[model samples]
Target: MKKMSKLEAVLWNIAFPGFSQLLMGHYIKGVLFVVLEFVMNVNSRFNQAIMYSFLGEIEKAEMVINYQWLMFYPCVYLFSMWDGYRSAMPADEKYSFLPFVFCAYFVTVGLMVSPKVTIFQVHPGPVFLPMLFLIPGLLIGFFIKFLLAAKLYTK
Candidate 1:
């Protein structure tokens, strides 16, 4: 197997849930992710929500969104990126899952808070708000990873 770049895997996954898996040579996993992505997107009316949210129609976006289905997205999407990155990298890499795990957690929290959060009295709407939360989540994940590395190295 040719060595693959973890960054490349992450970028592919960003483009589409399963694309990273495909790039990593995990055909079955990739197809499954793609199928899940399509199913969830349709059921949650995600694209419609995005369109409305981008247009500043917060109410319409909320009305069209299926929260239960939409909630699955962050976990699935983040997991795909993590999995692809993990698959491409050496197995011995430490704490590699931290960022993706925390990002998923934070994004979910963002999704939960999307209805009430506002910046300067302007609602961020669905997609963008959760993304904003991801920043903190990623930071927290890296922080934890750093702590773990320090502890392990000192031992």
Candidate 2:
């Protein structure tokens, strides 16, 4: 099989599972991707349960649920997409983990405390209703990002 450049390999792998390794001429990475996908799914579910258990405490509940989705999920998805896209470009770009770390703390802490500053609210339900929407929404976002990346990167 023909060899693919770094960028091509990353993109193809993102779009089509194992496509990247195929391009890089590494069949093993492609196969391992199947296992990686399963691990990620299981991990996410476990995290969801743990986060949900925090619901007993309103503050903690909002903190985990909102922070996970509104902040954590989007940032990760965007970063991955950007990384994958850059990798697919003619010249491969190095992955910088700093921005991701900065964003993680900034968004998580920001969202966690932002609600306290709110002036008013109509519904007094202990649990924030929006959490219902945000939780599932972010999960969907991840799935979408993965699929999009897969599409973009695959040859």
Candidate 3:
């Protein structure tokens, strides 16, 4: 029997993005990234709701947290695809961590303070506090990948 070509494999990766990466042998990178995306998606949903409430749009925030696809899922999936593609790249290239960090900070800030929506509600509960840990955790993950990139490519 004939075997599938590399292009076919890469195209499969595009379909699910990370699946092909796993098939190709980047299990650590692919699995971890998929997990990270899932965690962030959940966090984004929770925070997006809180942010909406802070902005005084309780209903909108609630709606977003409960069921807003346009706001979060697509973004997270795209990010996963990007990461998967990156992981699949030749292991001798330096990946930039700055862009990811900047984007994360921007989103956090936007959630915390968007003038278009008035933040009339503030929740000082355990919810807002978790992000204090999550932000840094996400950054650390990004840096870990950056380190791997540098280490792999530096040689």
Candidate 4:
């Protein structure tokens, strides 16, 4: 099987979770991720929400989103990305999953509060709100990972 660079793997998964996995020949996991993504997307009306949000219709996006089903998105999406990234990483690489995990946590929190949270009187809605929160989560997670790797996080 051909190996892919970590960046490529991550980017592919970001485009659609499981693309990297499928390309990397991890058939079962790739198929599973694809199936789950499909199920969650359909149930949550996520695509519609995204379209509405992109069209500057935040209220319509919010109305179309099924929070109950959408709640599962972050974990699955981040995990899929992580799965691809980790697989592509060198054997000695450590703590590489921290950013993805933290991003998932923050994105989920963002998703939970997206409906009520407003920034400067603008509602970011389901898609953009969670996406915006991802930046801080990545920073924090990377910071923690660095600390852990440097032994600065002593018990």
Give the TM-scores of the predictions, in the order they appear. Answer: 0.95, 0.30, 0.35, 0.96
lDDT by candidate, in order shown: 0.91, 0.45, 0.51, 0.95
Candidate 1 global Cα RMSD: 1.2
- In the range 84-144, model 4's lDDT, one tens digit per residue, is 9998999988899999999999999999999899999888989999999999999999999
Better of 2 and 4 by TM-score: 4
lDDT tens per residue, model 2, 16-112: 4455554545567545554554454354442443455454444544444434434434344334434444444555323233333344444445445
Q: Between the candidate structures 1 and 3, which one is better when assessed by TM-score?
A: 1
Query: Candidate 1 residues 14-61, lDDT tens each?
Result: 999999787667889999999999999999999999999888898899
In every candidate, how many clashes are there?
0, 8, 3, 0
Candidate 2: regions farther than 4 A off: 46-155
Cα lDDT for residue 22, model 4?
A: 96
Q: What is the C-alpha RMSD of each candidate to the true structure, in Å?
A: 1.2, 11.5, 10.0, 1.7
Ranking by TM-score: 4, 1, 3, 2
Residue pairs in candidate 4 whose N, alpha carbon or C atoms collide under 3 angstroms:
none
Q: Which ten-residue region of model 4 has the weakest summed lDDT? A: 146-155
